[model samples]
Target: MTTPNNTEHANIAVITGASSGLGEQFYETIAHRYPDLDEIWLIARRKERLEALAERYPNIRARVRALAFDLSAASSYDELSSMLAEEQPVVRVLINNAGFEREGLLRDMAPKDILAMIELNVMGMTMVNRVFLPYMRAGSFEVITGSVSSFAPIPWQTVYSASKAYTRFLARALHEEERKRGVNVLLMSPGNMNTEMNVQGTSTGKLGHLPYLDLKRETARTLMMAERGHATYTPMLFYKLYRLFAKLMPSALAVKVTSIENGDTHGR
Candidate 1:
């Protein structure tokens, strides 16, 4: 296994989807709190945004790295691993936070968009964990962002919910496998938040109303808790309660509710 850098294992963090929202929040929070991180790698399709975020902190700016690539492609994992090997940073943390969803009836959804959802949300997430496992094993933490939707089937956002379900299961399985290796794996399931992903009009009408959502800052805190080896983290208290309620509803009924909740938005 590639060992972490000289810094303590508790600090370094690599976050995907770092150009926006919850991922950005995690990056900023850790950069401010963990000065010992030898390096922080921000991966996303948006290179310009990642660069801008890096510029904000002189210390992080010095050690921060960014990779702009479409992770939906399987080849991206190999390329990312190559880059990491070249840099040889002791990567103590890895965040699999990039994902997308399609909004519509399964039959009406664009074929390409559905494929893209699977590619990014499920395949890409698996690839990220696989490519980074060696580096992480040499470190202390790993976190995968799942969703509350993973608990039950979601109708209009069918494939997306399935994708998150895969991610959640993957995290749990990986955590069990890596416990002895000293790497802690956390699966973070946040209720809706105010992000472009859930914006009013762009796509995927899976946005939870503001009164019931957890902001990005709280999502970041939940991620931190998971980094400490918590099995799962639900950022919103109501979301946690909602999950409990969801468990009581029939799976079929729950799916209908989700379809209604997400009917208005389109795919990303």
Candidate 2:
């Protein structure tokens, strides 16, 4: 249970979905700061893109490995475990950043899509945590990406909201469970961001036009802050206000307001 000193406790950081968006920013940030990082394993469905990112850092290029696999697949966890044991990399930090969204009315969304969301956001994250935690060193840690939406029930983005809620709760629970074991867990609840996940021309569009959408650099900075041991951190100020307002509002009213604001079913 020793404090994590950034300068002295540098170790490998494994980031899932590192091909683009916030995950890509994290990969770049860590690679720049911890040049001697034991290894940085990037997992995503796009191996080619991951390779391009790794090539940018020739020093750590040899240490960076890309594993392309659909995390939503049924046997993904077991397969990942085998790969890790074979590599035997000492993973000191884990970033669960792989996520996606299917925008449409829930009724119009395919049942299979909903199932995939649950499998990737919940089951996949849990599986990775279970496999890598035992291998982490004494001063190791994990960061799970939740969302501001996790704080309230948002319409239209139903599955995405619920998935992040699961992540937020799971991260808090795991932090308590792993403290005695010398492991730290952090939950990163970010507001809207300019990423592929938030489709262009959509209502949840990156806050570039509004006052929110945390930039990739800033979000990565906040995330690293949390990884260094803040239990819970939100990326932007307005998001904090939104969270407070949501908490104080009645459940029914809050949902209705969110639906109208986001142009969901209730608004119609």
Using lDDT, give the best candidate's number.
1
Worst lDDT run of 10 residues, candidate 1, spans: 1-10
Model 1 residue 88 CA deviation in Å: 2.9
Candidate 2 stretches with Cα past 4 Å from truth are 1-11, 197-216, 260-268
Q: What TM-score number comes out for model 2? A: 0.85
What is the lDDT, from 0 to 100, of the residue 87 in candidate 2? 57
Candidate 1 lDDT, 1-268, residue by residue in tens: 2433544333347888888877888787778766777778888898899889878788553378777888998778778777666665555777789887666788987899889989999888988887777666534788888988798897777888899999989999988888877788888887665666566334333453433354546755765686677777876677787688788999878776666454555332
TM-score per model over all chains: 0.87, 0.85
- Count clashing pairs, candidate 2: 0
**Which numbered prediction scores highest in TM-score against the true structure?**
1
The weakest ten consecutive residues by lDDT in model 2 span: 259-268
List model 2 lDDT by residue over 1-268, tens digit each: 1222224332568889788877887787777766667678888889899888878788663378787878878577778777666556666778888876654578888897788778888888777778777667657778888788788777776887788889888999989888877788888887655566553345443233445455656756765676576788876778788888988999788887665233422110
- Residue 248 in candidate 1 has what lDDT? 94
